[model samples]
Target: MIVTEIEEFSEIRVRARAYLCFLLQRYIPNYVPEPSLDNIINALKILKKELPQAEAFYILDKKGMQIIDAISNNSEYRRGKGINRSMRAYYYRAVREKRCILTDPYPSLLSHNLTVTASYPVYDDNKQLAFIICVDISLKDLLKLFHPSSIDSYFGHFTKISYSFFSLALLIVAILLLMKGVGSFFIMAFELRHINIKEIFESTILITLSLAIFDLVKTLFEEEVLGRHKKREASDIHKTMIRFLGSIVIALSIEALMLVFKFAIIDPQKIMFAVYLIGAVTLLLFGLSFYLKSISNIKEEE
Candidate 1:
């Protein structure tokens, strides 16, 4: 469950960071004249009113020491005073970047759950660092705030269930095709003296198609249901499409070859039909090549 939440967070991390930075810059002044802890706390309280999803808010002095207790609706997160936060990523990152930044999700001591920290560096009127304002929000709460289609939501669960049923059905079909293809091969193997070339080609086609469908099922299950990331070299959807089409092209080519051989042996006049089928297969191969080239160009542009 935590892994899933992290995956979802990564998907929306850029948007979350931008929104948090915008909010912090809008509510908290970039530079104040001798700002006090009470003034920062009041600003955080107002910010919390605007964003009820935040778990905790705390102010850290320029040296990365908590100046006062945290302000949070939950009591557990309200006792963070006198803590040394200089070693934390949020504290150091704010000092390094000199701007508002959002930290990656990590386990929170107060909530015992994965939480992200948004840190905003405050400066004094004389251009010296004054303090940093930090807010903590659970990954689940942040997802709910920004992404309505998160896996924990109703629509997301429904989509996962639908994909599961479709994948199961496709998997069963692949298994049946594999079984039939294997049986055909075994039967052909036993009767080697009276071998049928057409039967061999048919079995090969069945196996090829079955393997393509199985690949499709695996990709769909992993990407849609498990939220796994695909390799950057190619998109999963495009790769699946290419594999399925390539299988069909191979099966058609085999059929055309079988027809040419059969017609040349039995009825030479009917070989022209095999010629037409070969032409169609050639056209399909060309189309698939074009599709690949187009996607490659798009990736390069990106």
Candidate 2:
């Protein structure tokens, strides 16, 4: 009798997997728009009308990236939550194959339940790959699926406000650091003997131009080239290092000017101009080093 029961259990598992695969094949690849949140919303509406058993749904990019459903989806008691971010890879698989996918039962930690989902990929009219659409189904009120309750004391719950504040604080710190770099350059320039305004102006141009160019180039081209295969990129950290190292290089050039003032040429006063030249070259070198180091680190990270 025990052996018979074991055979039945295995049969159930096989049937479940088959049903999921069937659902994906039937309705996924043609389901949603590219991963824009607006189209995702519309897709959700249509899914509700056509498949009321569905609990929730989402569309992700080829990278298994969740395109936001606007401010509508958030982690809150009243707000909506979709799949946990960890499932991104599973969804991305369908996107890569440009086909539909269905997952066997998986646990949703947030919702504290086991559920099954099927993912569909949307393609452009050109038949180019677009995004993945995931659907959850249970024969009950769909909205309740996202509500993680009845055992809250067992695990810590968080407020979305805290997450927002953390992001804001990071942005504010970035602004302050940029302003500080500008101020430090002017203060150091003023300290030297008979500092000409022209030297300060030129140094300012070199520092600002190098940093901006470094930021843009690194983000657009370097990050893409180095992080193409990786799941995530290190763009932010790279920008930070570029600015820091470039500033240090510029500071050293300032010291070089002090050197030229003391002994490099017969005209001791001419050392000031020489200092500006050294500072510019130093910043340029530092920028290059920063760029190369960042690209190398991205390769390692990948």
Judged by lDDT, which candidate is best? 1
Give candidate 2 regions above 4 Å deviation. 1-40, 69-89, 138-302
Tell me how many clashing residue pairs each candidate has.
Answer: 0, 1
List the candidate 1 regions with Cα displacement exceeding 4 Å.
Answer: 1-14, 143-158, 187-197, 235-242, 260-273, 289-302
Per-residue lDDT of 42 in model 1: 82
Error of 1 at 109 (Å): 2.6
> Local distance difference test, per candidate?
0.88, 0.51
lDDT of 1 by residue, 165-241 (tens): 99999999999999999999999889999999989988998898899899889988987788564222367678888
lDDT of 2 by residue, 75-124 (tens): 33122334345355457567556555555455543344554566666776
Task: Return the TM-score for each candidate structure.
Answer: 0.78, 0.33
In the predicted model 2, the residue pairs found to clash are 257-275
Number of the predicted model whose TM-score against the real structure is largest: 1
